[model samples]
Target: MTSLNPRLGLFRDQHVVRLAAILALLLIFFAIVKPKNFFGLATWQSMAIQFPEFGLMALGVMLAMVIGGIDLSVVGIANMTAIGSALLMLQIAPVGSDASTGYLALAAAIGLSLVIGALAGALNGILVAKVRIPAILVTLGTFELFTGIAVIVSGGKPTSGLPPQYAEVMASRLFGVIPMPLIIFIIGAVLVGLLMYKSAFGTKLYMLGSNETAAQFSGLKTTSLIIRTYMISGVLASLAGLVMLANYNSAKADYGSTYTLLAVLIVVLGGVNPNGGSGRLSGVILAVVVLQVLSSLLNTFPNISNFYRPLIWGGVLLLVIVVNQWGKNNNLARLFRWKGNAS
Candidate 1:
């Protein structure tokens, strides 16, 4: 009889295995609690609608985390972009009866938002990488600064008067049943997945995260990579903001305030190391879906009390972190160690 390879017996990476287990458990929980709602097209559609915007933000957070940095400024970028897009769209639309002008204005708004996002991200990169500042402190400061700017610009008012065509495009189905935002989410996930997993830059990022000094000695342009990562994060967050603005048919200065923590939660919960160096975009995508499902299930319980949502979210986040650490450090490793000693 051939001897089995111990590594082959289990998934090569225990984190991946744990993530799969969590996914399975979530499915089972939903199946038991809300059998009909768990697998319905409507439920899926609802989740699809809500996930894309946050999913985009989470993708950015994943990239930053993979690079051993954090982008707390993302929520700020998102809010700024959202309000900027709304304001630009309003300005560009013709006053009386020019549909073509409205379309032109919408295009301008999107382009402007993308540019602003890139600039904002670049600024963050410069601060953290070139200025030699700690990412957490820099981003926290900018988080407040950017949000304050957004508030000043919006004056605490909800944006409205978007073109009808814009609203329709945002709300309309791509094919027959698929929501456009959901499709955007899928595309973003795939692209980010490829960028993070299959590209040279991705390798550099992982290397940098694993050891910055070693990466620098190895000839990696660490500073440039850091800048690029934040830029990408900023652009993604802005794109998500646009999707959100369209979906809600409004924009506010605080549109993405609650998302900073949520993004961190998703990235860590998706099996990305909070300390950086190892993570998968696919895992993040699955985590987003799982979270959306959990949120939907909670929503179905009318008397469950809305105030508990954050508490539950926090609890789940804490559980994921503890379980992830235990899986990596204690349970799985100890099992392998015991098997090795016995052998």
Candidate 2:
């Protein structure tokens, strides 16, 4: 009992530890309830392939939240960048092109798409940081603007018939055991971790999020930091776009339309403070897996409709927020103390 107390205290204080335990419990529950569906390699592989799209977007959302801002335009940026990439692919390597030419075109399209994402993000930064508009209002307006641009560019239709090379490389596994999307997600997470944990930029970002006035008085370039943060987010969103284009073998204006809400939910569920200045990348990553597992668990129930997913997600988000509020007030710890005494 004495030994267990330390672990219990650790779990109480560490968001990542709590998230990991919840993830484990969820996986075990699913396995028990639907062994045929959840105990197989196919289920896990499918989750690995599918979650990276929105998981990357969630990371972008996490960055924005960390800096005391929000980016509602991530889905819009992702879809728009994908649409642009698809259009570029059609022009550079039409059907009947050789595989080498298709690969070259794919590379060029990815670069250009990232550039577009950066520019779009920069625009949001300027509106929020320089124009003195609220972050929520700026991103809300740009969300519609970017989505509108995507619709116009794609002519309100799915852009398809691109070279097979894009999907082949993106959807293909490296060794027939691991997934390509999973690999890309790992790389992206690593880069973000380094940027946030190992650099001066990350220090400045936390400072700014904690108190913008203090940061400004301390001689930090608040505007530039905010702009760069959003730029990184845009790049991440664009990367997700490339992955989406590969996964679906096409692009559209409305792909992953529900992801904006999902991203915010994931960030908050990961124990990120919505008001900003405190979060862990590990917690966010774990939350992504936990949500994916939950989603998969839902799919195992044939009677459950897909439309209820958003409802479930919203409920879970609200519960997390309520719990976090309790934690902030130390009420959650008091409840734990009461339980411990009763035990």
lDDT: which candidate is best?
A: 2
In candidate 2, where is summed lDDT lowest over 10 consecutive residues?
1-10
Compose the digit string of candidate 1's lDDT tens values, residues 159-194.
887876676776778777899888877887878867
lDDT of 2 by residue, 196-283 (tens): 8788887787778888999999999999999999988988999899889988889999999889889999998887778777777877
Give the Cα-based TM-score of candidate 1 against the true structure.
Answer: 0.89
Candidate 1 has which clashing residue pairs, if any?
A: none
> Which runs in model 1 stand beyond 4 Å of their true positions?
1-11, 94-96, 326-343
- Where in model 2 is the C-alpha error above 4 Å? 1-12, 331-343
Q: TM-score for all predictions? A: 0.89, 0.92
